[model samples]
Target: MKTQIRLLLLSLTTSVFFITTSCRTELNEEIGAPQEQTLTANSKIADLILKTAMNDGSGDNILDGSSCFDISLPVTVVVNGTELTLNTEDDFEEIEAIFDQSSDDMDTLEFIFPITLIASDFSETIVENQDQLDALIEACEEDQEEDDDDIECIDFQYPLSVSVFNENSEVLETITFTNDEELHDFIKDLDEDDIVNISFPITVILSDNTEITINNLDELEEAIEEAIDDCDENDLGEERFIDVITSELLEVQKYKDNQSNETNNYRDYIFDFSEDGTVLVTLEDNDGDDTNNVTTEGTWSVRTRVDGGLNTTLDFGTEAPLNKLNNSWNVKKIQEKRIMLDEREGEGISKDELFFQQI
Candidate 1:
């Protein structure tokens, strides 16, 4: 009876030990395994990542005239007989403003070369003279027959992390990219069968400085598609407004004074903006029987304000009611049929409004 009891107890102890050991081994395996989520090959999300990571040359298209490449600064360029050393991107606005000052003269830009040119893949080439630059530009033009594929309106806010997984769902390596160049190269070199996962939530910045959070690949693709057409990617600059304003005869649609809290309806006035810096204003007197009209002359110009905003200055020499619109009005909106403007007093927008519509 003692031998039987001892044998039974030994068997129970052995069974319990094996059960605990097997449970521990399974738990360890589960804990060591990698997450199974991965990005699909040639997916829309992958395409978006590639497109957004591509170099955006449109921002400096004013200097190079090629959407395929950008002229790296601190490059010196002569703008309308004024030599300007553009040290940064903000300086490009000054060039546009200078070009906007006059529409009659043929706007000229002369580059003082030995400048660096950055390509769509973020590669750089040093050009010694205009000949070399022209050759590169010609090549870019040939290579890019279609519209540029870079999505300029939206960009990933880095640094973003991505993990590469192998066939067994084991992590091969992980990388953190700090800029577009790194991210672009990684995507460009990816193999079709490579399993990759991006660590979210990532942030994307829109053209208007709006920030969006992306939790997954679907959300990222949707965001890119939605914001792809949100802004003017052509880099038309101030010239866009100049062309619209000069091409038509406009009439005062709405004018209001914030200081006096008064509104004026100059519906009977017709304003013509000539390309030669002259403005013709014709006023019609509304009577019960017949219409009498008076025409006046004014000088007009578009210039860059100290704060880099475009302003349209009007000087209708001592003319009643028309002279009230004489301030250097800041451009608020420029539409096909309407131009909106305002004047600010000191800190906040004074709300003194002026609007012109096509007649």
Candidate 2:
């Protein structure tokens, strides 16, 4: 009997200890601290994210709220006083997956204590057009969620201003970004021509609203060249030919046609847009019965307006699988070997969006 009682007591004690431990873990966030980019308009840019920018599971303490970071530093940014570093692209991606779902305001980056980090906030800043610039500015002006201890920190320190140029290489306007109200004002005054992807030496805006004044002349010049293309084309802009569109290595990429905001990523179909405006759609696992892995052919072209916001139009010839892509959609944006196209609200496209990347 004594031995049995002892055993029972030991088991109970162990159970109690475990329960207490679990409770502590559940409450750890309250006891401890928390931690937490951007466009290519919000989630597309992968390299710009840093591991240090993640939110502290609590969602209330998103450190890299502005998606701004200085990669040159070992520790990119601090969140709730914790130091973090990005070892790989995955580190940044993890943060992107978490905080992006948040509609709440984010916490300003906070250092552990007395630690100094000197680095250029963002390594590369590409303002593709006026819409992108507006998106970047709006992202920065977003208010940090309402809280008892939330800091009223905007993305930048303040007195932020940037120059806008026309396609003719003329200065259009130099607007100063101060608060969300000012951002709205800037947007109101924005013209389609002011939204050029043409010239470079552009001031890249950081997720934190911080600005890096023309990192180099190359990016600036590239942007200007793109602008010249548009200006030279009489504002209708030249076509993004099939060759240039599909020239991103090996000539193929997988695309997910997300309709009604739903993505069929698992479909994983390869879209091969050839130089002759022909599109070859292919998928694996041919059964020769019911659903053959047949290559579907289609035509493609870049339109100036009907596609709305200057993008490409695809005609899959009303075929079984190709009919889904028979709409004119704007180029959502392109990064390296990837191309994303989506339908604008006022545009004549009925589908949602298509995301393509070299698989």
Candidate 3:
């Protein structure tokens, strides 16, 4: 009986000790301190996010009632005493993931520190779980779902190659087109005077039920050059485009607000043409009062307006045109003044319209 009692007491004591140790570990593992970047596997850009909140100022405390809608500026952050740098682009995903998994709560305002800190920290995690950290960073750095704006596009205003062939597919003429005075002078000497390809039309189907079209390449080019010159007269050439419709002016709200009532304002857009005859475009501007202060930004599907023969019209995806009547679009490139839209069309349209130069 004595032996059995001693054995029972020993077992109970061991169980109690194990439980105590486990509890102590759980308590120590609590995350109370700021995370260090060197120990992380991802690259994060650090930007300072300021919000108007009602929190006590530790100089690091966020303001009262601030949310993600607040203006956020891109910034770089250094961590581990400036030994590491982080870029928001790289670590945005990973940090977001960590927040999702670890914290049941989130702050309305967040800060992105810097990129330099991330670079330094990445080098520190080179050994041991460096591979793991790298994998984590890559996973976190997974490219965010990009909108149409993230699509690849180009802007070209130059000459291109065009080949003319008879029904027999025999090459008749191969020529290049350019707005350059020298090139135009050369084309003027052509004997046949038959142009297989022409400039891409500048077409705008506006919101107020109006359509503005510019089909003449020479006229369109002249208008753009003239507008640019006019802005240059006031030394605003570097600042303003020849024609600006709905445009966005950052760090300059009052001026932007005056230009258009649309919340997203800014006439400048990106235009890209692929060698395979794909035209891509994206516009950046807010078009309303934006009372909530969330700067509106989005992109538009590139429309294929005109084909090479001047009479052919190609339609891109079906999206109602939101452009205003006064909006101006321009063709930036033409290969022998030819626009390429498909393969069956020989040598594709050479001259590519690069962008909609809003007037």
Number of clashes recorded per candidate:
0, 16, 62
Candidate 3 C-alpha error for residue 278, in Å: 50
Looking at model 1, residue 270 earns an lDDT score of 84
Model 2, range 1-359, lDDT digits (tens) per residue?
99999999999999999998887565443222221100111211111121111211111112222222222222354533434564543454434344334424342333333222211221235343435533543343232111112112212223545545443444445566544335334443445444212122335443334555543334433333333223111111222333336765222233345444334532545667776667777665545453666666777765323112245668767655557667776665544455667765663443466766665
Off by over 4 Å in 3: 1-196, 204-212, 230-359
Which clashing pairs does model 1 show? none
Per-residue lDDT tens digits for candidate 1, residues 1-359, read 99999999999999999998997566434433343335756776777888889997766766765556778889999989999999998888888888879755767788997899888789899999988887777666555434557787898998999867554544367789999999989888887656787888999999779899998777888899999888645432245456667888998877888756333547778889987778998877777333467889998876544333467788888867887888878777666677888887775445698888887
Off by over 4 Å in 1: 1-70, 79-84, 90-110, 113-155, 164-175, 181-195, 205-213, 218-236, 259-264, 285-291, 303-309, 343-350
Winner by TM-score: 1
Candidate with better lDDT, 1 vs 3: 1
User: In model 2, which runs have C-alpha deviations exceeding 4 angstroms?
Assistant: 1-244, 248-268, 286-292, 306-308, 347-351
Error of 1 at 3 (Å): 40
TM-score of the candidate numbered 3?
0.15
Q: Sorted by TM-score, highest first, which candidate order results?
A: 1, 2, 3
TM-score comparison, 2 vs 3, better candidate: 2
Candidate 1 lDDT at 231 equals: 62
